[model samples]
Target: MIFFEDTVSVVKVAVSLLLALASWLLIRFPAPFRHYLNPRPALTLWVSFIGLRVIPFIIVYLIMDFAPRSDTEFFYKKAIAAFAGKMVYRDFLSYHGPLFGYLISLPLYLWYNAKILIPFMAIVEFAIVWATWRYYQSSRPDALLMAVLYFLLPMPFVAMILSSEEDIWFWGVGLITLAYASRAQGSLWIGIIWGLSMIVIKSMIIVLLVPLFFLVDNKFKYVLGLAIVGIPSIVILYLLMGDAFLMPLQHSGYNMTPNIVSITRPFLSGVYNQISLTRLNTISLCITMALSSWAAIRYRHLGYRQIFPSLYVLTFGIFMLAQPSAPGFYLFMYMIVVLYEMVKIEDRSFNVQLILLNFLIVIEPIIWVIYVGMLNYDDWHTVFSSGVNTADYLIQVVEVGLLLALVWRTFVHLRSLDRAASQSFAASSQRTGSSPVS
Candidate 1:
């Protein structure tokens, strides 16, 4: 029965990949057929928003069994427990932020069930689609395109809203904050507050804030805004939970043996335990920080809009690499960055590469699902305990390959921009009959 199930899963995956490739070919080639998928701007926007964001949740809820040991169940229980006056840090040892517990608990306040949380998250997904549309100042067709892509995108649908992961909420808040940060007329302070609020919900989201310094006009106001919200929140949390307030930070570092770092155990001499994993993560983090600093300095002149994607990819990519586990769901951020860049860049090769990269990103999680299905277990935790399989190692390799591809493409794009700027400056100097400055 297990072999039969695994074979069926493999067949399904093969068929899906073929269909995806065929669809991409059709979209890229036949000009007339392209118009067939295109609808009126407003109608497309609304349809994509509703169909992608809401309908999938309904479908998943009806189709899949909500596994008892799933992340959603874990969160639901924590939310309920927190709402019942249990201290999240002291009592539950939650690695999640305080605000996350309170936020998830809101759905339980009305009716207690995991299903109820879907709609709450779906609403946030709607906000993300809308904010993204506005952020790009895209045409109705472009807005519809983004909405459709996000909705149909496998990464967001499968890893996030389908599982009711908190990252979906964090992603939405991050998008809204980015939208505000990018606008010339938008308030930096408001963006700062929103960014800080995202951190309060999931401290990992603090990585998203790195780009805001480049995006915002007033650095001082941005710092002030962060301090305004951050200082008080920390003090209050400390007062409420005492030293337990620091538990999330500690919990964040706990090595979940399945991460990129742990996958290297076969190459190393030591046992693959938490302490070793933590040390590996520390080394990864240091490398990431150094590379990120160099990128920031080298690309300092790029506009906020242009540089924002690199900042996101670099920061989040590092976090994922350094963290104990790389949940396929988090790739949704990569999807967002790549999709936005695809729309913005005119280079056909770059766009195609981004499209292919997005496809690979989508495939990773599906592969993970198949691997888990092969385990034939009702409890999700059992699959983790069963140890890393060949499939797990394959997916990690795919992830690293995709990350390198994105980083390479970003650097190439930035260098092209620099070349164009230099050429334009030289031309202007010639026209003015003045030697170009050294």
Candidate 2:
């Protein structure tokens, strides 16, 4: 409905949606275009992937430019007495991260009255694609698929491309996390880059760090590397913004609760007013996270490289249940990593697992749309207003389903690792004819 806001004709919206969905279908399942989808002449494939990310970005940019901005982006238009020559970092209020806002404005301050976000975002996206392609040679095909998936699915992409907002930093952290994880060596510099990126865009990159921590081979090197990268960036942020530097962190922690009860209560027609308690959610999340960590530690001997997928599962699973909000964005990004693994598996038995995983991948977005509509029924008039909102009740259900599905998968994956470990241990003991030393 909002897509037709610019035009009074209803037919236009129908046409636009049809075209968009058709484009999406082709993008998601470009099987008929296998020559294009598969490895081709290097130049042709590179151009095709670039076209995929850039063309959509351009389309969205045009739409956002045509649309009007809400007052939220320019909340402090007047000269603020509090921040005379400084940047604002009001808690939950500021739209962009401090660094992002400044960087976004730098070009505008120099070039003209135009927005700096779209072009800067396009550049950042291109870099992420380049880096991902460089890191995962075997999965370059999947990486191209991932690049499209990232833009199409992530909330940050919507904010950056469709709304012309400054959420480009989310992708920056996402790429960094993936790139660093894929690398054989552990680097402190990359860790700090990731940590700071999370500080700015917590929802997008926070859980990705879990994989890095668990996957690094040397514990001291891992901890030291991350601390060196993370600690200084934080300290600098504090020095530059003082209390405001803490604002983002505080806001992130505040929303740590999984709001499952609140969102789902009305759908069940239950009388419960508040969603499940944050404390309870937090405790459950902690327990789940601990179990995931144990699973990683237990299976560390399998080699650090194998643990990346497990780390992602554990990280994203815990996060989805930990927070009450839609896990769509985080789950979607992590699915890219998960799908890549699924394709790499040669075992036929894992086909059942593949089917289930693929089912979730396909249905999650559609379910989320319905769930959003249900949860926000009271605000029905504003459904799909400025941003996409579905029925509030439906959103509640999908959120719950997504959270549970991920957690269930994490436990299953952990158990698989445990079984594999036990078999390996038994075989070694049999060969030695002695009880194996721990």
Per-model C-alpha lDDT, please?
0.59, 0.48
TM-score of each: 0.76, 0.63
Query: Cα miss at 387, model 2 (Å)?
Result: 20
Each prediction's RMSD to truth: 5.7, 7.2
lDDT: worst 10-residue window of model 1 = 374-383
What would the per-residue lDDT of candidate 1 be over residues 161-205, giving only the tens digit for each residue? Answer: 546655655555655555566566454554566656644576655
How close to the true structure is residue 81 of candidate 2, measured as C-alpha lDDT? Answer: 16
Judging by lDDT against the true structure, name the best candidate: 1
